[model samples]
Every structure is written in C-alpha cells, then in structure tokens.
Target: MKIWNEPYLETCCRAALHRLVLVGGGGRPDGLKDGPCLERLQGMGLARLRADGRYELTEAGRERHAGEILKLRKAG
Candidate 1:
C-alpha cells in the first residue's frame, strides 16, 4: 500500500465536505482510511468528530470552502 500525499488531504477534504453537504454524507474513497482523514481534516480546521466514527464541519472549516466558492461566484 502507498502512503497518502499531504496536499491530497486538502483536496480530499474539500471533496468530502462538499459531498457531505451535497448528498448529506456518504462513504470515503476505497483507500482513504477514516482515522487519518478525520485527523487531517480536523487539523486543517474543516471538521470534527462528534462520536467515535461520526464527523461534521467546523464553522471555520465550512466557511473556508464556502468562502472560496462565494469568491469565485462573485468574481464571475
């Protein structure tokens, strides 16, 4: 098995967050382990676990990506 690239965490986290917000949550990529994803996203200020296996967006985290999309939409 291969180790994950650090930058991929940001990208994956954004996609995962969007998926959660879009479809109301779902599964991870096959190779994306849950523990590390949670750790990475939490570190980046985008999410937190409520219970052992449950996660949700932090306010700063939600605004991080939401702010990005809002900027792009405004720019267009």
Candidate 2:
C-alpha cells in the first residue's frame, strides 16, 4: 500500500504562494516575477491560471495559506 504525502514547497514557492494570496480578488499583481515558483505551485495543485491570463490560488491553496502561511488552525 502506498501512502500519499503532502508536497513540499521550497522557500521561493512558498513566497510565490504568499504573493498570490496577497493579490486576493485576482487579476495579476504587479511585480510577480517568480515564474518557476508559480509553475511549481501549479504542478502541485496549489495555484491555478485564471481565464484572464492571471494566476490565482485554488481552494487547496487558500487552505494551505491559512494553515501553513498564516499559521491559522481550526479550533478542535
């Protein structure tokens, strides 16, 4: 049996994820120069391309941002 593991993002990729979240409402933000990092995030399903030719965070990405980036956790 194989166990699925969470993808590990490097510092650059994590920074890219943060940038996407900061953009919020969506529509490419200025100064987003991390193409490779964004591509890596896309491959991991953490971010996606918008119809307007911009990249945004997916639901999974938001959750990850909340948990990993913002360090927010659900109350147990």
Candidate 3:
C-alpha cells in the first residue's frame, strides 16, 4: 500500500479550496480569477472539475481543509 503524503499548497490555493467548500462544492463561478489556483489544486488531486464546469473539493481536499484550514484533527 502506498502512503499519502500531504502536498504543499500555496496560500491562494488554500483560500480557493476554502471558498469552494463554502460555496457548497459546485455550480456557478464567482468570476474567473481562480483559474490558476484551481488548476494547481486539480493537479494535486485535491479538487476536480465537474461536468457542469465548476470546481469542487475531492475527499483529499476536504480532509486537507479540515486539518489545515479548520484546524481539526482527523479521527483514525
């Protein structure tokens, strides 16, 4: 089995992930300023683009958010 090492994310990308979570994880773009951040997140397997063309957090992204952004500990 492969171990999961958390990828390093920039401040902007973290903010973008938080925003994605706040917005219910899909639908509607609040402008296009986050393209680069989204791309980075997508490349890291943290976020994914939906069929409707909106970006949302994957399971890893949500876990990252809970740990990094929200400062919550993950339960084993």
Candidate 4:
C-alpha cells in the first residue's frame, strides 16, 4: 500500500468527495474511469477498475469516503 501523507490523503479525500458527488448526480464522467486520477486511487487500493472500465469503491475506499465526509463535516 502507498504511504499515507497529508498530500496523498488530501488528494484521495478530495477524489472521494468528487466520486460521491458524481455518484449522487448520476455517475462518473468517462474521462475519469481510466484516468490517472482513478489509477492513483486504484494503486492505493481504495478503488477497483472494473472490466467495463468503471471504478468501484473497495471496502477501504468506503471507509475512506466516510472518513472524508466526517473530516469535511468537522471542518465546516
């Protein structure tokens, strides 16, 4: 697993937030499916690339997503 740092956490957290918003709106954009952004999350084991080229949240990702939401709620 990749080391968790402030920058990486921020990136992943923001990505998680974006994913949440997109999921709520409908779905992810095509560009994000196989993009480097998702790839980074994939490498971190927070996301999985499906055979259809879509990203699905791993269990870790679900936790991260919930954690990110908590952080944001606290920040606000």
Q: Which pairs clash in model 2?
A: none
Error of 3 at 52 (Å): 1.1
> What is residue 12's positional error in candidate 1, in angstroms?
1.9
User: How do the residues 6-55 of candidate 2 rate in per-residue lDDT, one tens digit apiece?
Assistant: 78778888889988888887645433579888878888898887767788
The Cα error of candidate 3 at residue 56, in Å, is 0.9
Instruction: Write down the lDDT that model 1 would get.
Output: 0.59
Once fitted onto the true fold, the runs of candidate 2 whose alpha carbons sit more than 4 angstroms away are 1-4, 29-32, 72-76
CA lDDT of 38 in candidate 1?
58
Residue 41 miss distance in model 2 (angstroms): 0.9
- Per-residue alpha-carbon lDDT of model 1 for 4-75, expressed as tens digits? 443444555566666545533442333345556556777777776655456666786667657654565689
> Which residue pairs in candidate 4 have backbone atoms (N, alpha carbon, C) closer than 3 angstroms, thus clashing?
none
Q: Against the true structure, what is each candidate's TM-score?
A: 0.53, 0.76, 0.77, 0.61
Global lDDT of each candidate:
0.59, 0.78, 0.79, 0.62
Backbone steric clashes in candidate 1, count: 0
**Model 4 vs. true fold: TM:** 0.61
lDDT of predicted model 4:
0.62
Give residue 33's error in model 4 in angstroms: 8.8
Single out the weakest 10-residue window by summed lDDT for candidate 2: 67-76
Distance from true position, residue 64, model 3, in Å?
A: 0.6
Most TM-score-accurate candidate:
3
Query: Which candidate has the top score in lDDT?
Result: 3
